[model samples]
Target: MSLQFDIDAVLDRLATDGWVVIPHAMPAALTAELRDACLQVWQQGLFHEAATGRGDGQARRAEIRSDSVLWLDKVATLPAVAAYNAAMDDIMQAVNRGLYLGLAELESHFAVYPEGAFYKKHLDRFRDDDARTLTTVFYLNEAWPQDAGGEIRLYLDADCTQHIDVTPEAGTLVLFLSDRFWHEVLPATQQRLSVTGWYRRRGGSVPW
Candidate 1:
């Protein structure tokens, strides 16, 4: 995947609007491989119902979000997943250099939202945990139509009025400041697939 994006411009967007979107960030072939990997995981029953919160508070609640996820290892058995992890590591270095963010690691997972699945608006990072500094989501749904109804809506302010919606299109990448934005996944008329991840300030050689 030799796709390139304006890294400086994207970082500037993160500084200003707290979020940025890059269409076709991943190469078509690579995106196809990733999509296939996700579907394979689903078929193999490798995903678990997504849970909210952390530690003891973590629990699955269908009412909040009905998605299945398989957390990705930085060094995955799948070649495509390994390539993406390496790419993200490079981007992470660039981000840290530009912002002086002491990001130590990243954790990612493939998420699937079936029909009638929605996630109520919420912030990725809790007020008490500032460790989660950045969030990234890459869509793997090819040819997602406008009326397919699954769009991640990003609220611009505390009141949740001003917002922007993004489609679940293959190769599209979304980056945002995790603590600043409030976002939600709308019900999908069809299944929606994506790899969502977080960059953390946590230490050690592994992602927390």
Candidate 2:
């Protein structure tokens, strides 16, 4: 059974730790469905090599990141994508109500990190614009072995002195402040499947 969403617990963690990981945040059946969708889309050749930066300033640099991505549209008719976005709507409402974050919109995409793929440590907010206020990564890989690595490292400071490494287990949700934390995906021995997204504030360039 899917566990109920715990808004208070999530909010408390965000306030104190600046990040949180919720196990079983999503239903197993939904995750399986989404995983199938990801594979299907990938087979359809819809995913692209992910790029960095924002707006006109973006470019692909393999050294910085090496994941393939397929962005999800809120209005998409795809059942998996549309259902996921609808669930996020309630969460966003709760976040804005509890924290007054002024988040105006959200964007999400399927990210597939092949074996040996990794992303260099960086904040989610663009340097030229502070529109992205929060970030979320939802894992859809079942039986993710700890030894398979692909763990996400969240640095506690600007210099990476203290940090936490999290396994990308199926149904796991990682949430953090976009500009306040520096994080990265470590090279994985196995493929990693996830949906990464951001909540943006007003006046931010639409995160298409």
Candidate 3:
């Protein structure tokens, strides 16, 4: 099916469920470009396992290298990425109403989790940083399955008790309020690739 870019419908669902999936929001060709970019970065030996040096960081068995602003500089400037970002901007505007300004940073992340690699439950946004309002994730795998195991589980409450599980499907775009939700990337029985990032409101920067 062709991707549908329904900003209002998606925003409405996000407000209610704390998360929404815009299936195939990305074009097949763009998805291929992103996948190729991620693979190229991997070949350059720039990938590394995500290490937080804390007990809470043990779930992810894959590697992660940041500095996406640089990686996306080349990709985002491409006609395909520019068009996608424009669509995302429209969605952001619909959510924030007339207060939408501009993106603080566009992070390009490549996640490669082999079988058993997973990210434990965590929130993308910190309580101290309110500038980060929206988090977006794009799947790169072509034909992900329901049992693929690399799904994102998003908490639906403040207590992190109730939750919803989202399968990682190619060309799928998932977005939600960054700070208001807690989520995790489950272990995959096979290799998984994706580009995940956030759109922030104008604000002072936070130390990572």
Per-residue alpha-carbon lDDT of candidate 2 for residues 81-134, written as tens digits (9 for 90 to 100)? 777777777778888998889988888899999999999999898767778998
Per-prediction TM-score to the true structure, in the order listed: 0.94, 0.94, 0.77
The order by descending lDDT is 2, 1, 3
lDDT of each: 0.87, 0.87, 0.69
Top-scoring candidate (lDDT): 2
Per residue, candidate 3 scores C-alpha lDDT tens digits across 1-208 of: 2236766777678766767888888778888877777777677776766653333443433343222222354555555556666666666666677334354555545666656777777777654555566788888888887777888888889998898887888888888878788888877888788777777777635543
Off by over 4 Å in 1: 1-3, 203-207
Worst 10 residues of 1 by lDDT: 199-208
- Which segments of candidate 2 are over 4 A away from where they belong? 1-3, 205-208
Better TM-score candidate (1, 3):
1
Cα distance off (Å), candidate 1, residue 185: 0.2
lDDT value, residue 179 of candidate 2: 88
